[model samples]
Structures are given as C-alpha cells and as structure tokens.
Target: MPGIDECLLEVMRLPGARGAAVVDWTSGLALGTIGESPNGDHEATAAETAEVARMAAEQPVFAGDAAVAGPGTRTPGAVPPHPPGLPGLAVEDVIITTAPGYHILRFVETSFDSSVFLHLWLDRAEGNLALARMRLGDIAERLVLA
Candidate 1:
C-alpha cells in the first residue's frame, strides 16, 4: 500500500487533475495536500468538501436512493441493503461536477470508523470523469489509514 503523500501524487498524475488531498471528513481536516486547491486554500477546500462527504455518508436516504452509483451519486450510510442490522455506513465515492472543474470524493474504508476520503479536483475540459472515478477507487483501496 502507498502512503498518503504517494497516493496523492498518483492522483495528481491523472488527466486534468488540478489538486488532491486526503481529507478527514469527520473533522474537516486535510491530512495531506498537493497541487492547486479549488479556493487557493487547501484547508478551506477540505472543510468545504468534507461537508459534502459527511452529508452523503451520514444520510441513509442517499444509500436507499442509490439505484445506480453514477456521477453526483451518494452511497448508502452505515447500513446493509438487507438484514439492515449493522450501524456502519458505506460509500464508493461521490462526484460533483462544475463548469470549471470536477470534484471526486473517494471514501477510504478503514478498519475502524472510515471517515477519510480522497478529494480530487480536475479541469473540466481536460478531466475524464469515468477514468478519474475508477482511478480514485483504486487509490482508495491501496490507501492505508493507519
């Protein structure tokens, strides 16, 4: 597995990648950051993005509504689709596209409370949404939270 810094570097190598960070959605903190931030401030961007991640992860309605995990889609929160017994939440990732860029938030599943996610900012014209999402998923898997 790669460390947080290395993982973020790999993310920046992606097409259209403008900035990347390992953000703790629970506390709205950026554990690591690289490249240019959306607002010229990595910390603020991390906090702002964490709001979206927290909202998506903590809400059960999004999970239940996730018929398909397409762009701008939010995964289910800490519950099983069936049996519905576990208090744990779930998420693959979340993508928010804009006129200027695309935001990809890939959730990192930890052995404990999985509150961290990888945030990637990419240029709208140069970025490939599908590719970025898939690559982020790969990075998320290799990311070690400890």
Candidate 2:
C-alpha cells in the first residue's frame, strides 16, 4: 500500500491535477499535501474542504435508507456494511465544479474513525472527471496512514 506522499504523487499524475491533499476532516488538518493549492494555502484549503466533508458525512439529510434502518439491524452511530477496512458512510465523494476547475473530495474510510479524505484539484479543460474519480477511489483504498 502507498503512504500519504506516494498516494498524493499518484494523484498529481492525473491529467489535470493541480493539487492534492490528504486531510483529516474531523480536525481540519492536512495530513499531507502536494502541488499548488486552490487558495495558495494548503492548510486553509484543507480546513475549508474539511467543513464541506464534515457536513456531508454527518448530516442525516445526506443519509440513505441504510442509515435509517429499523430496530435491531444496526447500532446507533454505526455505519452500514462497508468494505473490509472502510467506513460505510452515507456519502462517498463530493465533487464541486467551478468555472476554472473541479474539486473532488474522495472520502477515505480508515480502519479507525474514518475522518480522512483525498482532495484533488483538476483543471476543468484537461481533466477527465470519470477517470479521476475512479483512480481516486483506487488510491483511497490502497492508502496507508501511519
């Protein structure tokens, strides 16, 4: 599995990648970063993006039927069935499209609290959204945070 730096390097290899970061949404901290930030400040960008991720992960409005199951199927605060080491959060990824670029937040489901995600900034003209998304998913799965 790749570490934060390795994974981020992989992210930057994508066609339109301008910047990338592994952030902890719960704490609004950037665990690791590479390339240029959208705001010229990776830390601020991470914090801002964390707010967006935190909302999507915690809001019941984004929760699907799995989060609202009847009586004994699940415990309070517990997510639904997920991949082997990932959290089964209601939202997987959040993509925000802007006039010049695309911001993609791919949630990383860790074995711990699952508060981290991979943020990618891609040029709108050069990026292939579908390919970036798919590759991000793969990278997130293989990321190893120590």
- Please, what is the whole-model Cα lDDT of each candidate in the order they appear? 0.84, 0.89
Error of 1 at 57 (Å): 0.5
Task: Name the Cα RMSD for model 1.
Answer: 5.5
Prediction 1 TM-score vs. true: 0.84
- Tens digits of per-residue lDDT for model 2, 1-146: 99999999999999999999999998999999999999899999999999999998888556654545644666676645543434467678999999999999999877776789999999999999999999999999999988
Against the hidden reference, what TM-scores do the models get? 0.84, 0.86
Worst 10 residues of 2 by lDDT: 78-87
Which of the numbered candidates is closest to the native, going by highest lDDT?
2
Expressed as tens digits, the lDDT of each residue in 1-146 for candidate 1 is: 89899999999999999999999998999999999998999999999999999998877656533544444454434333521322355556789989999999988876786789999999999999999999998898789876
Maximum-TM-score candidate:
2
